[model samples]
Target: MFKFQLNAITAVKALVWTAVRRMEVKDVPTPTPQPGWVLMRVRYVGVCGSDVGGFLGKNELRRPPLIMGHEFTGVVEEVGPGVSKDLIGRLFAVNPIIGCGHCRYCRSGLKNLCLMRKIIGIDYPGAYAEYVAVPADNLYPVSDPVRGALAEPLATSMRAVRLSGAGLGDSVLVIGAGPVGALAVKLLSIGGVKDVTVIDINRNRLEWAGRWGASSTLSVTGDEALKSLRETHPEGFDAVIDAVGSEDTRGLAINAVRRGGRVIFVGLHDNEVTIPGNLIVRSEIEIKGSFSYTDEDFLKAVRVLESGLLDPREGWVDIRPLERGQETFEELAGTETKYVKVMFNPGG
Candidate 1:
């Protein structure tokens, strides 16, 4: 397949003088799977907020001339030596994180926190292509390609709720209405949290939240958000999830949670944020930071999604062809749209 031309949307670096940023499709040679790896015929890929950030050069961890897509579904088209051939025709949702198995975190099943972790699309090539190679261990079989593309983000939401420890009848506040935040709200509701409030500056997103599982939706910005929160839940929520992760949202999470309540930071929109040390110390509030998902969380996400607990097809997700990745990324970064999430069909 060396002469076979395959197309990929790759983030190419412009000269230092130019402001141009965003990936473009290029015709490249199809990759052959190495030992322990399999080549996947890319089906669907999700455009994450971080993918937008990376395209805009906002994520310091991602370098240009990369293929930036972690959430994707595909069919195994070829298997390398030592791998089973039966996987060649099966569909899968690819887990993008490849952890060094010897790390302490990996041994504890917290591979998300592995010290020597390499993420697909960021550290290596990813599925924003006609075909890409991934380790066989990272692929999980699934039935639907669209829903399969959501496994990574759903696993992230699952990790956030697990870290928050919000229980039955607990009052929870989700601080964003984007895909992850919306999924958090839905999962919390499925976990039996009744009084869930979702806040965002976008009215359309807030509406989506309400439809998903939130009992209340607040469309507020800056200080007004805190005021609205106080007015609605005078005593504050039992747990606050900061899914936007801006300085303002961090502050809101700190002040909006009841004394002794938990606060989970799930968003990485901002590089750094300041919080009131005195408030956290005095209230004895528990503040936790959640990263990506563990293997267990990823598995649970697949099961929950398969059970139809939360379906992205119900109108929360939008699909576009992979060729439009640059335009879609620009649109998503340039302005806030009604779409809570957007997925790209790479096979098209």
Candidate 2:
């Protein structure tokens, strides 16, 4: 068993989201796990793009006075009633989605589609603190905290790639070149895709995408990039993933995909976008929205992390202490920031 000093601790430090564009470190009462739940000592918690949206007051699903974080990894510190003590000291990556067990979606292991689902960080208290209590079933054993923290985002990327139906020798275009887009490129490469093109306005992100298995990177934006893409690949790409769910990217994904090709929408940047419905009908282009991963996908992500197929310490990742949450959020909210992914060590 791992020896921890948590037993004597009654209060823990947490980064609380007080209002729009504001987060402060405060001492909060340590959570007591309910039956079938476990209290975990949070080690690493990733600041997702959605969390940035929450910080910018753009995400409607997130409200102020909430603990906003969904990607995290920790060690089991204490187990509640009916839980096994064997889980103590074990490192784990959390499946943040919680669903009603009796729902049809949950019964089929598609908890992401459950209508009454509650996410850890969004719905309940999250791991933006030194301790978090989550259901025992949501814990997946992991060896490394950093890699474990990546499992959630990787699962999202995996779901998008899987839904795109891109396979060996396929030509795929990934938009945004952000964390999810970069991860999609890596997955496509690992799945034997022949050509993976990543496009982004940020040249730095495009460069990182190239290193992350993108066959080519395009540092272009708006209609100019679209025209260039059309001129270069007149036949259009076999698959196009819109990882930046803005109006322009959505339209570009629709226009850039080949006839009958698949287009996967993975980003949540914009809720509403207008695309050419007539063109979609004429080309028979299949369009699908990829949401959070299913239980199976999350498990596969953990296994992939364990296999060392994805490196957690890539140049795109920035690690900081929890006290730096405000500055980190501000930096990420800015357009000129170079940080692609930031993870916080709450216990530091």
Q: Clashes per prediction?
A: 0, 0
What lDDT score belongs to each candidate, Candidate 1 first? 0.82, 0.88
Report the C-alpha displacement of residue 303, candidate 1, in angstroms: 1.1
Clashing pairs in 2: none
Candidate 1 C-alpha RMSD relative to the actual structure = 3.8
Across 31-69, the per-residue lDDT of candidate 1 in tens digits comes to 677788888888888887777777777777778777778
TM-score of each: 0.92, 0.95
* Candidate 2 residue lDDT tens string, 1-348: 111134456788999999999999998878888888899999999998888888888788899887878899999988989999999999999999999899899899899999999999888889999999899999999999998899999999999999999998788999987778888988998888968888987777777788878887787777888888887688899999998788899999999999999999998877777999999999999999999899999999999999998776766788899889999999877655575678999989
lDDT of 2 at 297: 99
Model 1 spans with C-alpha error above 4 angstroms: 1-20
- Please give the TM-score that candidate 2 achieves against the real structure: 0.95
| TM-score of model 1 vs. true structure | 0.92
